[model samples]
Target: MQAHAVIDHITGWLKDYHATAHSKGFVVGVSGGVDSAVVSILAARTGLPTLLLEMPIRQKEDQRERALAHIEDLKQRFPNVKAISVDLTPSFNTFAETVEVDESEYPAKQLALANARSRLRMMTLYYYGQLNGFLVTGTGNKVEDFGVGFFTKYGDGGVDISPIGDLLKTQVYELAAELEVIESIQKAQPTDGLWDTDRTDEQQMGATYPELEWAMSVHGWNRPEDFEGRQREVLEIYTRLNQAMQHKINPIPVCEIPLKLLNGS
Candidate 1:
């Protein structure tokens, strides 16, 4: 489908979801990244009161400044969307201290930490949503969520609604461009910003989004019969992520056990 149609489809979907749920509005976390930027714009255009949250950790001066600036810019364009900033460093540090596992045992500790930040931000959103009446809007795209299972299960993955869950990374960028998000963020490297200085999402995933996106379109995860070597490797990664994060995609497992015997035998 074309990018314009995709954006309209997602916007309509979100509007329908809100109407059915009787939500007062929408809440979106803005990470100074393209995905969230596009989502914020989409939410605002839906005519629902949207909230853009900036939850920063012990980020560098430059990073924090940029994040705040992005929030301010959104505030100007989206008067109905309230932009707020909250520092989450103390909470994350406390959570880290409470966990017993060493960093080596979990090479992805940084990712875990980042997930904690995401989750905390979600919790904050929920609290505000409760008081103000709004549903939490997820910023995850299909590429990040499906290709590498990059989201933190209950953390970033927890949401009342996901407007861009089905769009690939490339598609998301295209939509962002159409939405006219700031050039810097639209062209910035994608990162979860979990640690002081961390590798980009592509770096950690071991494959760039463009390459993985192509493989996904061609193979569709389960791996076709013709793939070989590196192609097979990429397929495996994608399949593992899809399978591993299946729980996040579907929170409840389906049970098919019989409640009672046909004749009470």
Candidate 2:
């Protein structure tokens, strides 16, 4: 795990991709978490103009402070990095008040509002990307992106390409250390930051990142043929999480040809 090599690889990827796409720069939404911080630095290292937005919609002060601090540090290090702070709380409030929904559908209303926050952030990032001829970069790691589908579909999940999507949660931490990301962000708990439920990632996922990474590395969507007690329990937890997030993990359903089509009806 040579951190320097990993950094070079990711930076090179961004540079090449930007040149190939003929984009002016990159747009990244920083959440002050390890994953986003790493992505922001990687994008900045490309030497292309990069826009970092701290879009906080009713975000906790701790989260917003960390994000701002990270942006300030990264800007000092990278001349091409530009930072902006946008408060979306007012916009969110307007939307929440305007939209009519039945509170009886508890889960529906809660999740919808949460996802709306993410979508609003996503839209803001794209607006900057398009206006400045830059590509939007996503900050999802492998454990969250594929294993558990921890991101909102077409929200944070929407991007031109994922640089670290191949790396697991543990691996992202490794990269964070290698990239010299701010200590506060590196040590901060991971969160989607879409809601003020005050719940951490582990609380919501029902498993810590280390445990999830282990499950992904060991079982990986496959049933454990022989395991006992805690081992089996972990496997079961992985199965349940994978199943629950199948909609996000596998969003598009396959379509098959009908018999009528085969017969040239």
Candidate 3:
């Protein structure tokens, strides 16, 4: 299906969900990125009372400014929508100080810290939702959520509704184009904005998005193709991530015995 059609279908789903649940509206996190921008637009277009939260922590001034700009634009587009900004630096720092680790574990520790920030933002969303009668909207796309398990288990992954989980990263950009998001965000590289450093999602994935998308589209999702070099690499990464985070995706397994009789009956 075309990207626009996909957006329309998802928006329709959101509308139906709202009608069925009798919800007050939807809440979305605006990360100053294309995925969130598209999600915010869809939520607003559905005529829901959308809330956009920009949670920044130790990020560059430009990053926060861009996020605020996107939120402002969303406000203008959807007059009924409300936008708010919250600085999460204090909470993030407290969490970081509490987690003890060795100096050798740099990136891993940093990743855990970043995931904490994401989870904190999610918590904030739910707190506000409970107070205002809204459902939290997830901004993760299929490429990030499924391809490499690229989200914190209970952090950014936690949400009441996911509108873009079925679309690939490339398709997300297409939807952003259809939604007329800011040109900068529409063309910008995807990042987690976890630290002061400039880190691209593709860099962490160790492969270009087209390459990863093609692999996942073909072999991972069974899109018909010969499994070869790059395809093999993609499969390796996918398998590793899948196995590594299997526990996170599934409920805890408990041993069950069929027909256990109490009191030796």
The candidate maximizing lDDT is: 2
Model 3: lDDT equals: 0.82
RMSD of each: 3.0, 2.3, 2.7
Residue-level lDDT of model 1, residues 1-265, one tens digit each, is 4878887888898889999999999988878778888888899878889887788877666556656777787778877878778788888788888984887888977766777777788798788778778998888988777756788877778888888988888888999888887887877888877667766887777777886787678655356456778877777666666677676666587766665764565
**Backbone clashes counted, model 2:** 0
Q: Is candidate 1 or candidate 3 better by lDDT?
A: 3
The runs of at least 3 residues in candidate 2 whose Cα sits more than 4 Å from the true structure, single-residue gaps closed, are: 220-225, 254-265
- Which candidate do you rate higher for TM-score, 2 or 3? 2
TM-score-better candidate, 1 vs 3: 3
Q: If ranked by lDDT, best first, what sequence of candidates would result?
A: 2, 3, 1
Error of 2 at 39 (Å): 0.4
lDDT-wise, the better of 2 and 3 is 2
User: What lDDT does candidate 2 reach at residue 196?
Assistant: 71
- At residue 170, candidate 3 shows an lDDT of 83
TM-score of each: 0.86, 0.92, 0.89
Predictions ranked by TM-score, top down?
Answer: 2, 3, 1
Clashing pairs for model 2 are none
In candidate 3 the C-alpha lDDT for residue 98 amounts to 85
Cα lDDT of model 2 by residue, 1-265, tens digit: 7778988998999999888999999999998788899999999998889999999998998998899999999999999999888888999999999996888966588788998999999999998889899899999999888887888888998899899999988889998888888898888888888777787998888888888887887775467555676666666777787777778866498898999999999
